[model samples]
Target: MRRKSVVDTLREIRLLSELDDGEIAVVEKNCRWKTYGASEQIIDQHSDSNDIFFVVSGRVRVVNYSLLGREITFDDLEPGGHFGELAAIDGLPRSASVMALEEARIASLPSDQFQRMILSHPKIALKLMKHLAYLVRTSTLRIMDLSTLGANNRVHADLLSLARKVTKDDMTAVIQPIPVHSDVASRVSTTRETVARVMSDLARKGIVERQKDALVVKDLERLEDMVEDVRGE
Candidate 1:
């Protein structure tokens, strides 16, 4: 239900929210859309790959594992979110793995291609750097939370992140659809059972509504309050 152009796509992500008209034009000219099957490995962990991809449709799970075989989720990327950005910019190997959560369509722009597009646009590079810094800080906070918080706190944080992307008013949040419940569990560092219970509780309280496969959050203030209480740790 969203526009497929780079401008509309950038509007959905915080990083490119501030891009100017000229910068947007450059991105539109360079991005190329591609499709992937469900369960495909979009990017392998520790792989020396260098293309940044935007999810235009479908979902991706950014996951990594610990020495003890625990899978930690860095994020569940939906439409309008991007991955491989840090590696593409810094020439580093990918730090995490990305798998398609469903049949997906992605727009990928490789590092060399990105550099060619922005060759004369030094300001765009600076803007992107600033954006990546924010992601690092955000990821660190989630890591810290997972180390210290319980299931409730983790779920609360996840909801807050979802809330930020959802175009909503006082009573309805239209979040992009996400399948693969295990992906959510990984990001929260909890079991899927816990997420299910919490969601059931929210549904009972009329704070959320199931829209076929996706959720429509109906009470933003309560969701925020729950996260605030957890953060009070």
Candidate 2:
């Protein structure tokens, strides 16, 4: 694609939408595009590469390995999502690995360029700070969940988080492209068998139903209640 098309694509990204046309043009001229196949590692944990990556197509996962070699998934990101900003901003090694969950296209900006953009653009800097604060808040919550919540509650919380509200009149929601049991287990720091059992119990309780492509949440309020009950315990 031409440079202008690339600029337009970048403009669509929420983080970059605030940039003026001249700034966007500069980014378009400086950024490099790269593609990775499914299961390919885009960035390794503790690596020193300080380039920020923006997902332009497909999906990627942020993962980290425990000392015992267990893999934990932090998040799944899709188009318009970006990662590696933390390292790029802080000048630290990557805290986790990033892998392409499917064939993916990414736009890469060198650390120097990213820093320059943030320094020159007050809105961009503000957005970056907000994004980092969000990451910190999310990490704190995850730590709390891991330390205090039971396995079942963790699974419930994970499912509820993955669900998106589907209707205005009712509490119906859906997790389209519902993740596999093993992936959910990884996220919740549990085994697949436990996740499967908890999911089965939820189904039996009529809280959620499994469909071919998604897990339909019958009552989002009930799911929220479940999490609150666990918190109260």
Q: Give each prediction's root-mean-square deviation over alpha carbons.
A: 5.1, 2.7
For candidate 2, what's the RMSD? Answer: 2.7
lDDT of 2 by residue, 112-156 (tens): 999998898889899888988988998898899999999999999
Model 1 spans with C-alpha error above 4 angstroms: 1-34, 54-58, 67-70, 78-81, 105-110, 116-119, 171-180, 203-219
Give lDDT tens digits, candidate 1, residues 187-227. Answer: 77888888888888888999878787678788878887888
What are the lDDT figures for the candidates, one per model?
0.75, 0.86
Query: How much lDDT does candidate 1 score?
Result: 0.75
Query: In model 2, which regions exceed 4 Å deviation?
Result: 1-8, 165-170
